[model samples]
Target: MMTVTDLDCLRGQRRVLSGVSFALDAGDCLILRGPNGAGKTTLLRTLAGLSPAPRGALSTAPEDLVYTGHLDAVKPQLTVAENLTFWQGIYQNAPQDTLNSFDLDELADRPAATLSAGQKRRLGLARLHVSGRKIWLLDEPTTALDADHVARFTDTLQAHCNGGGIAIISTHLDIALPQARTLNVADFAARQDRTADEEADPFLQGAY
Candidate 1:
């Protein structure tokens, strides 16, 4: 089980969302819904420990979580198989059929830089299988995927949850994951009143 209570999210010292809270048990998925700049990414970054720890509690251990952001995180020069193998080595996990898992077997030897956008997205997501973590934090995971690949990814997500994993995703698309609940992040928007000092700082202007 994972629990977050009274969480606060920030973007470069500017508070964006506050009093965020949620809990999820094994085999659960939560979808974050909000418009651009509504702090969805900030919240995910905070939960993934990429940002400073906020004024709240996260019950899950750091080692149990894996985060995937907007970028695919692929190595351009590496072949598809090599990329998965590289992550498998980093996580020190036993070998997994990652290529087959994401339907990358046909292009296993292709360099990541040569693949289409959707193929690269698949390769990026395949890293999750190699990661062997219990919790997944994804941001707009289906960015470039076509219909068929989207269905494939949906099945993959279902399989993971069925195996007692947890997923929290932020997406504008309506992905029909069974029993998944949605959280509208706009509800937690923080009200900021900038002080004179803050207003005078050129670096702070137009910061997201």
Candidate 2:
């Protein structure tokens, strides 16, 4: 199980989240929902250990966590299959059905550089299957995906959760995941003095 206590995150010098707490066990999915600039990505980064929590207790091994950021970490010079193979080598375990899961079987041999934005995103998502990690931290994973691709990705996430894998995703789109807990990052925003104009747009309170 992964546990968090009073996690506070900052973007540059501006404090974003304060007094945030949560616990996640196997087969659990947690979704972070908020408008852009609400620090959803920041919180995910903090959880992934890419950034410090400042003040919090996070229980999880860095190796056990697989983090997929907003950007597709695909190498333009590599082929789609090569990319998956690279991760497979790192994890030393890869799901046999990973190719079909993300509908990339036909594109397996294609160079990642030739793939479109959505296809590159699919390849990025396919890496999760080969990660062999207990926990997944995804930030806006549905980017560049069409409706059908989104549903496909959601199904993959659902299966992972059903198989006792943990997933924490930051996304604005409704993924319809089973038994997933939603976290509103805006609720944990730090209370501080801001100009009246800044206060008017509540969504602008936190930096992305």
Candidate 3:
């Protein structure tokens, strides 16, 4: 389980959100919705432990959290299979046909540099299959996916939740997620003072 209490986050030296709180247990999903610059990404970054939650409580450990931001993090020179293999190794897990899951089996040998934008996005998402972490933090996950792939991704999320994993995704797309809660990030946005130098919060780290 993951928990947040009265969370306040900052971007640079300015606080972008405050008084934010939520709890996500096994098999739950939280969807973040808000306008541009409403701090959705910042909130996720804080939750993922990429940034500090200056004021609040977060319960989790780093090893249990998996975060995928706007960038794909794919190496242009690596093949699809190679990319998945690298992440699979990091998680100390064997390959689990992630390519097939994303319908990239045929393109497994192709270099990421040759893929289209949508294909590259799919490759980025495929990393989810390799991560054995319990908590997922995804930003704009469905950006370049087609309707069919979106549907597949929804099914994947449902399966993950059913297996007792929790996910928080920020997206504008309409996708069905089991037991999903919608959170409008704007509701948590607030302005506050912050010092130029501050250490990151350790409470937000995920469990192994």
Candidate 4:
């Protein structure tokens, strides 16, 4: 199980979100919903431990979590198969059917740079499967994906949850995951007025 208590998130020196709390058990999925700049990414980063949470408690080990942000994290020079293989090495997990898993069989030998945006996104998402972690913290996972691939991604997420994994995704699209519950980050927006220094910080005003 994973638990969050009174979580407060910041972007640089400014607090963007506060008093957020949630809990998830195995086989659960939580979808984060909010308008742009509502601190959805900040909350995800905080949960993944990539960013410090000024005030909160996260009851999960770092080893159990896997985080995927907007970037695909692909090596442009590497072939599709090589990319998955590389991540498998990093995660120290057994090899997965990478080609078939994300419908990249035909492009397995092709360089990642040659692939289109959607293909690169698929390759990035496939890393989640290769990670073999219990908890997933994803940000805008379906950004460049078409409808068909989005469905494929949904199936992949469902399979993960069915196998007792937990997923927390931040996305604007209406992804069809029947069992997934939604959390609107806008509800947790920090109510404090920003100081002059915070207002002048570009990092705070930009996407959190």
lDDT of 1 by residue, 101-181 (tens): 789999999999999999999999998888999999999999999988989899999989999999999999887887799
lDDT of 1 at 81: 87
Candidate 1 error regions (>4 Å): 196-208
When summed lDDT is taken over every stretch of 10 residues in candidate 1, the lowest stretch is: 92-101
Q: Count backbone clashes in candidate 1.
A: 0
- C-alpha TM-score for every candidate: 0.92, 0.90, 0.89, 0.91
- Higher-scoring candidate on lDDT, 1 or 3: 1
Candidate 2 to truth, TM: 0.90
At residue 114, give the lDDT of candidate 3.
99
Instruction: After the best TM-score superposition of candidate 4, give how far the Cα of residue 44 lies from its true spot, in angstroms.
Output: 0.6
Per-residue lDDT value at 74 in model 4: 96
lDDT of each: 0.91, 0.90, 0.85, 0.91
Candidate 1's TM-score reads: 0.92
How many clashes (backbone N, Cα, C below 3 Å) per candidate? 0, 0, 6, 1
Q: What is the lDDT of candidate 4?
A: 0.91
Lowest lDDT sum, 10 consecutive residues, model 4, at: 93-102
Q: What is the per-residue lDDT of model 2 for residues 6-71, given as tens digits with 9 covering 90 to 100?
A: 999988788888988999999999999887888898898898888887898888889989999978
Give the Å shift of residue 14 in candidate 2.
2.2
Clashing pairs in 2: none
Question: What would the per-residue lDDT of candidate 3 be over residues 42-74, giving only the tens digit for each residue?
Answer: 998988888987799889898888889889989
